[model samples]
Target: MQLLLIASEVFPFSRTGGLADVMAALPESLVRLGVDVTVLSPWWQSLHGQPTEVWRGSVPHGGRLQPGAVRVGEVRAAGVRYLFLGTPDFERPGLYAEDDVERFLRWGNLVLPTLQSMGLTFDLVHGHDWAAGTVVAHARAAGLRSVYTIHNLQYQGRWNFAEGAAWSGLPAAMLPDAEFYGDLNLMKAGLVFSDHVTTVSPTYAREITTREYGEGLEGVLQARDAAGALTGILNGLDLDRWNPAADPDVLPMTARSGKPANVAALRAEFLLDDAPILSAVSRLVSQKGLDLLVEALPDVTRDWNVVVLGSGDPLLEAALKGWAQHPRVRYVSGMNEALAHRLYAGSDAFCMPSRFEPCGLSQMISMRYGTLPVVRETGGLVDSVPSDVGFRFSGGGAGDLSAALHAARLAWDDRPGWQARVARGMALDFSWEASARRYVDVYRQVLGA
Candidate 1:
């Protein structure tokens, strides 16, 4: 089967968050399942390596044709083709621009025509998040099968109705679904027009049908679910990139043996004493429940050594930096791939207290490195980490997190039980192969093939 996957970001080439990782791995996994897949994404300034121009074209915008170019590239790891839409509007420093809705509308307008120019045909056009939501609408309008995946509902790409209508170049007759409460909501277009809608995890899929997690689109999603057009598929990890056995940075430790050397190395590097180490690798944002962690830090630092890696939200960064002065706590300001691997390998437990996580890769990566995860019982964290493998708390509050952390510490003190838990976590499989097979089934269901 032929497939076209569209997203705003892709890993290794360009990335800002989990969406990039998902786009990078999923297409390759589909290719391994014998599906011919092509990816479409923007040409961000951070994008490494050059892609040769495959086709040049113009998209209709504001009653005029806007010039654009299509550059073809290959992901060597997945053996899948990727095409980048290059326009001056997209040549920015960040993955998202202030005029993201306008930029992506231009991108969506060009997708089908660009494929036609390249003489490429696909059985399905899959759009990821709001950035590519209009692409799904375009595919559906053309009477082609389309799937839309909502990575996060919070970012719906809403704009002023008048401004959107002026810039989008969409037909007048198709305005209802695109407009919500005098604003243009791109996410609504996908949920309303696509053949199918999917989220990263089953829990998240169900959660979005309600007002609490829906971010103002619950009613639309509920209607789609009633129509049998919604699905919840758990995400899979890039096993090759996160494998502990093969990762050069990780200390050589089998499932049977413990990672003492790595633990010692981490303690020495951070100037920490012989205390149970708790680590977190996440962007410091409220969505990640960092506030809860901050509230519980006083009690947490009294017991365990804490290390944090990642940067976001200047206010939260400042708060965490202040806490860094605490003797048992250390904070690194940005993402370091090598350090992340080592930290995962060395830590006794990994913390993820997300208020609403769709499908987190960090908990999975932590497990793969033989570090048990202590997470809030929400979304993918609930699905991936079982009672035997890790600790989970229910309420999204400081007390709840503190209790879970205490339990983890108790588990840590039980050397035999902790080893058993670590072994179970490491033995669990979260590879992309299983996830790809499930996606193949979704495709077949959509095509009736």
Candidate 2:
């Protein structure tokens, strides 16, 4: 099957979040399953010197034909073709900002036409997140099959009709699905126009159809669910990229046998004295529930040495930084890829107490490294990290997280039990093969092929 995968961000070219990783990994997986996959994404200032094929096209916009040049950078990676589309406005310094929504909405007009100009054709178009939805919407109008996946319902890409809707060149009469509270919600357009809808995790798929997590599109999603047009496919981890056997920064450890050496290394680097270490590699955002971690620090740190690596939300950053004053609590204020691997292998436990996680990669990585995950029971965390594999707590309060941490400490003290839990976590498979097959099935079902 031939597939055109559209995304707002593709790793190694542009990225701000998990969407980029999914875009890169999923296409690779699909190609492995014998699907002809082509990924399309926006070009940004970060890609100024990258290799690409350039072409000029004239798109009709604002009651006139607007002449513009579109750049298509081509790269063949992991058996998939990646196309980065660029225009003058897209190259203007940033991938996303408040004003970028309208620009992206308008960029939808550039996608299919540019592909046609390049003689590219596909059986179906699959779009990701909010920014790329218009491609699916456009594909639907043209009588082509399309699938839309919501990576996170948190960002819906709502915009004013006058400022951005006019750029789509789609008449207001043809855009009833895009309407949300008298405004244009691009995510709604993607959901309503696509042949089928999907989210990152099954739990998240169900959560988003309810008022609490729906973000004001519950009615539409509820209808999709009733019509059997919605699916929740769990994301797969790239084992080769995250495996300790291959990662030079990390020593290969199985079931915590070799974890002590790495733990000593971490203690030496962070000036931490001997106590079981609990590490977290996450953005310091309220959504991540790092604030709950801070609240539990006083009680949890009495016995555990804590180290956190990430940066976001200035207020949360400041609060975490304040905890750095304590001898056992170390907060690294930025993202370091190598350090993340070390933390995964070295820490006694990894904490991911998210308010609502769609599908978290960290817990999987931690489990793969024999680092037991202490995750709250919500969304993918519940699906991925079962109580037997890792420590799980219900409720979204600091006390709940503290209770889970306390269990982790008890488990740590019980070496045999902790090792057994680590072994179980390591035994779990998270490769893209199964998930890729599921996606292929979705493609076939959508196309009736």
Candidate 3:
């Protein structure tokens, strides 16, 4: 099957979060499964990758005399075609900021038309998040099959309706789904307009249909669930990159034999002088429950050494930086790909206390490296890491944080049991083959195959 995948960010080429990693890995897996997949994303100035074709084009809106022009480049990476649709706005430092909708709409409009002009066609269009949803909405309007995946419902892309209408060039009548509490919610449009809507996990899919977890869009998801158009598929890990056995980031080690050597190497590298090392590689944001982690740190770090690497929320950054001065804590600001992998393989345990996670990749990567996870029982964390695989705390609050960290400490104390859990976690397969199969099934369903 031929598929058109539209996403806001992609790994190696362009990235800001987990969605980019998903976009990069999933296409490669799909290609391996005998599917032709093409990714469409914006080409920023910082992007440094080789492409087969590059075309310059314009997207006109609201009868504007001077349209937004972008340089669209087509590159094949890891067996999948990448269509990088870049605007001058994307050439800036930040990917999302003021006037994001206008920039995204311009990029969205440039995707299909560019492909059509190049004589390329696809059986299905798969859009990721609200930014890419504009493509699916346009596809639906022009009678095309499309699938929309809700990676995170909380970021619904709500903005001023007047501004959105003006930028989108869609009539007020055409903007029904976009309306959300006197604003335009781009994610709502994707959920309502796409042929199929999917979340990252089965439990998350169920959770989002409820009043508490829906973030006000539960009613819409409920309607779709009633119509039997909603689905939940667990996101998979890119084993090629995450595998501890072959990873370049950490001392080469497999789940079976390299634990002692890898652990020793990690400890020496991070300067953890005989202290049990615990690590968290994540954005310092409220949604990630970093505040709760911070609160729990004093108690946990009294016994374990800690290291953190990530960048977000200036307040959280400041707080973590201050905490890093503690005898047992070390904080590395900003996202580093190699360092993240090292943390996965080197640390004794991994922590992910997300308030609500769609599908967490860090925990999965940690599992591959035999780094036991200490996580909150929510979303993908619930689905991916069972109690036997790692430590978990139920609920979403400070109490949950304290409880989870305690459990992790207890697990860490029981050497034999902890080893067993870590071994089991490492054995668990999260390869993209399964996710690709599910996506293929979705494509077939959309085509009535």
lDDT on C-alpha atoms for all candidate structures: 0.85, 0.85, 0.82
Candidate 3 deviant stretches above 4 angstroms: 50-52, 59-68
Q: Root-mean-square deviation of each candidate, in angstroms?
A: 1.7, 1.7, 1.9
Residue-by-residue lDDT tens digits, candidate 1, 143-166:
899888999998898888887766
lDDT of 2 at 50: 80
Error of 2 at 12 (Å): 2.1
Model 2, 40-141: lDDT tens digits are 888776763485665666644422335656667787777988888877777667667777778788778778877887788889999998887777778987
Poorest 10 consecutive residues of model 3 by lDDT? 59-68
Q: Mind giving the per-residue lDDT tens digits that candidate 3 earns over 1-449? A: 88999888888787888899899889998898898889988877677665554666554431332353655778876789898876666778756787777677656655676677567888899999989767887788768899999998888777687877666655466687768999877888889889999888888999999987899999999999999899999999878878788887777887677777877876777677776788999988877887887877878776688889998999889988999888788899998888888888888888888888888899998888888888888889989998898888887777777677777777788889988998899889898888889988888898899
Q: Ten consecutive residues with minimal summed lDDT in candidate 1?
A: 59-68
Backbone clashes in each candidate structure, one number apiece?
0, 0, 0
Candidate 3 global TM-score: 0.95
Model 2: clashing residue pairs? none
